[model samples]
Target: MSSSSSSSFIIRIFIICGTIFNLSHQIKTIDALQPMKSSSLFIVFGRPGSGKTTVANKAFESLSLDNNKNNKHQQCIELDLDVCISQEMKDNFGRGIYPSLKERNVFASGACDYVEKQLDEKLLKCQQQKQQQKDFNLSAIISFSFVNTDLRDIFRERFPKAEWILIDTTEEECTKRINEREGHFYKGDTPDKKKKEEEVDTTTNEEKDMSDWEFNPVTFPHIILDGNDPIEDNANNVVKEILGKNEEI
Candidate 1:
């Protein structure tokens, strides 16, 4: 072969070897930087229109700060069952009956169950996959209504390792806020209508004075924040609590 042709062949071989070596090195670097375990799960529970989404967003922001500051690439997932249920209801029942649909109220029960089950399955799969890879970091944040202790217990049983945060807001305040918020499932005169419906005597089947659902304390391991308080302050307090920092205004 000619000298110039031989030199060109050698250069081509060197380029191919260099490319393979660089690719292998990159794969090792990525594997080393990946998280080593599943991320933590956070469940934020509150009544309808009690600023659950607002608080969850704020909490995620604060957690992101911690993750960034620590140089940890942890994953955070916020799943709100209300939005899911509302969208499902709208799809099935249309907008009109959505106001008075007893089925919609029961839908929350079923949707929450479905979501919790799905989350459990996904978490298990993630853990198994990570076990193979020898590195996995995954977590979840679920926000839903905590009107019933049974429901909260079900969540605990489903995700035994999850961190629970319950936002306790008075029924009166929730109703008022719901009324003020437009385009919400519980917005407008629907709040007053719900109050009236709750007052109807089940046995007598007679409409009585207006009443709202009572705010019951959730029985779970949780950090409770008063929803009636300022949103920003309450959210900051939640961040502090989660990070084991001193609670400040």
Candidate 2:
């Protein structure tokens, strides 16, 4: 071929390659801009009296109201282990509180079942609502004293994508809160409210004292929030973290 003809052919090839590259880049940009379908499960946990439920509830309310940064298609649910425990007690024992180690163990197992059932239901619902091959987002905010690493592992295995949030507080502060709180079985005063009233101590009994339980990260990454901070601030920070504003969701 002549030099001019060869040059023209090379130019045509370059133009085709550039067009393909631009199209690929534009596709990626559009995908990045689009709202992704997500199933966000956040487990807010800490030792008992660390205000896990308080902040978890506040974050749930805030995230719900904001629709998690205006993702209108998202569905959010809050699950409290205490609430499940209460229900379990009421349904099986016709009581609101369980004090004995045997009773507590029974109720705790029942409560875990309840939580897992709710999670399974949510997962099924999300699976069924396959609209146009684009599933709407489902956000589950769960609160519990997930201090036992083994128990945490059970959930981590069940929901491989679940995010963990830990509310960090000193044992002293937790003991104070437990003492001040009323109407709960895990109150500061136990086994008759006198010798046990002054301090919250761990026991080697069958039913472990949750206040004495400490968190072990154990291969799982978690978002830690200061328990000393205002609950509202912690709540807002968690929402930001979950919404991918402060950190990767």
Candidate 3:
């Protein structure tokens, strides 16, 4: 065979071998992770504008179960509570919901309810299907600020093997980010809407018990990730850290 043809043949062989290796790895991982071994609740905790979403998006993309026949829906699904709440608000009300920075407690209370519901539903399904180890594949990555210990414990109970990540940035930087950020629910496109959203009492606490989680001083033990760096770089580094940790599994 010609050298070029030989090279092409070798490449095809490599691809086929890689596929087999990937399948083997998937099965091995599934067996090892029986009863949700590969499972972990990656907590992206930070005040607004600390690049929580960016790192989260990157982590979701980077982490995944190896390709297997029963793993079509396999992925690191992000339960971004902020987006979920905005969506929830839109569903209940006729328009979008935008809570001010100070009204974070209201947002958190609503989001916690929604997050718990999601966990209950997903975990129920997982428990029901735990016997099917061959098809076992599900992991939830929640991106939210666990400003208090109670909220953190709630998720921890549902997902015992939780991973904590706190994006460290000053409030001054977060304020600057709040002003510069666009397409945010609270950070409206038009000046008028922005002013209105920024104004207090625009979002009613229908239930007064929705006190803020920030009052809880206890923060979960977390890996401090630098949020000041370029988003992509920061994301890639966070992926490296997570993947590095999972290399043993």
**Which has the greatest TM-score?**
2
lDDT of 2 by residue, 1-249 (tens): 999999999999999999999999999765544444355778888877899899988988998888646665556789987775554544432221324545545555665567667755665554555321343556778898865665675677667788888898878999899879876656543454444444685566544543223455546688888999999999988777677721243
Model 1's TM-score against the true structure: 0.57
In angstroms, give how far residue 7 of model 3 lies from its true place: 70
Report residue 113 deviation for candidate 2 (angstroms): 4.6
For each of the candidates, give the backbone clash count.
Answer: 4, 0, 0
TM-score versus the correct structure, for each prediction: 0.57, 0.60, 0.53
Clashing pairs in 2: none
lDDT (Cα atoms) of all candidates against the true structure: 0.60, 0.68, 0.60
The window of 10 residues in a row where model 3 has the poorest summed lDDT is 91-100
Regions of candidate 3 where Cα sits further than 4 Å from its true position: 1-38, 64-74, 86-137, 148-150, 187-218, 244-249
Write one digit per residue (lDDT tens) for candidate 1, span 1-249.
999999999999999999999999999866654434344666777877788889888777876677658623244456777665656655432222232224434655676566666555655554445432323344566777655544556556656776777677877887688767766554424444456457745733221111223345765567778888887887787666555421210
Q: Among these predicted structures, which one has the highest lDDT?
A: 2
- TM-score-wise, the better of 1 and 2 is 2
